[model samples]
Target: MSELGIHYRRGPATVTGSPRPRQGPHAGDRLPDTPAGLQRRVAGPGYHLLFGGPTRSWPQDPPLGGRGDLVSVHHLGTQSPWPGITHALVRPDGYVGYLARGTDLTGLRAYLDRWLPAR
Candidate 1:
């Protein structure tokens, strides 16, 4: 079974259940076999996980942390209301998923200069 779960934060339109089983990152994909691997996938370029609006699932993981261009939401330790908000790929339902702060990939690409370069 999938180890993922929707994080229930204190807010309206709360995340209900695990995202209906889809393609890509499955339960046992094993992409993030280690911390560094996770780091790469989360912050890798050409990828941004967006939530809300018509689009449901993100085709790719979000970007990682940054100082000037890419603002690391996780690093900031805060939360912003969603509409076009995205975040770093730190596991869909991991502990950080429930955290108040993290990265937003859509914002990163739109504002930041970071781009997903093939690795």
Candidate 2:
């Protein structure tokens, strides 16, 4: 599997337990393993926000700041597994909760508010 593109998504399972053709990273799909150091960093509690490359600007207050302990951020430089993707939010369960191909974080903020609303 490692030989395949990191963005590859397994086909979804059908009601009869057969796999259905699909594409792209969907919510609940298991995140492919990142580099060892990054994997270790996210092995604990909290949702992890991974930046694929150097960002020009980032929010002064990250989403879900009220639950800071439950959120952490990491920069993967150019070695990010998700080629062409700018950001990837991995949930605590090791699934991809969100993904962004551009620098705009509006969608990311909305996703956080909907799922991990700040208290």
Candidate 3:
């Protein structure tokens, strides 16, 4: 990536329960049985990233724009080195990006209509 560089390239990501459980009776199961525990669990980074395969969710947050809309689904990762694979770039200021074939980028189109220069 031009900004974060290859280090941030973790690959297509997914979300999952946290690694550590607070212990107690309800540990080892879904994040937390109690509302408070759930809060704490989500308070921290809790997503598993996956690279190439079928469509999946981002482990962390999806690439975000300055105004708060998901910008792109593809990002640089170990599995996506050398500008390889399908990719897209979103701008915080609302810039149009290239969308690879097979991806449903309806959200991007909506954003462009509302934010991009002409829109």
Please name the candidate that would achieve the greatest lDDT relative to the true structure. Answer: 2
Candidate with the greatest TM-score versus the true structure: 2
Model 3 — which ten-residue stretch has the worst lDDT? 12-21
- Pairs with backbone N, CA or C atoms under 3 Å apart (clashes), candidate 2: none
Ranking by lDDT: 2, 1, 3
Off by over 4 Å in 1: 1-17, 32-119
Question: Which tens-of-lDDT digit does each residue in 54-106 have in candidate 2?
Answer: 55444545555476777788767665665543677787867676766656677
Shift of residue 100 alpha carbon in model 1, Å: 18
> Against the unseen true structure, what C-alpha lDDT does each candidate score?
0.30, 0.61, 0.28
What is the C-alpha lDDT profile of model 1 across 1-119, one tens digit per residue?
A: 54343333333212212322222223222223232344443454332232332233333334433432322223211221222222332233232222112233343343233333223
The TM-score, computed over Cα atoms with residue i paired to residue i, of candidate 2 is 0.66
lDDT of 3: 0.28
* Predictions: Cα RMSD each: 13.3, 7.5, 16.7
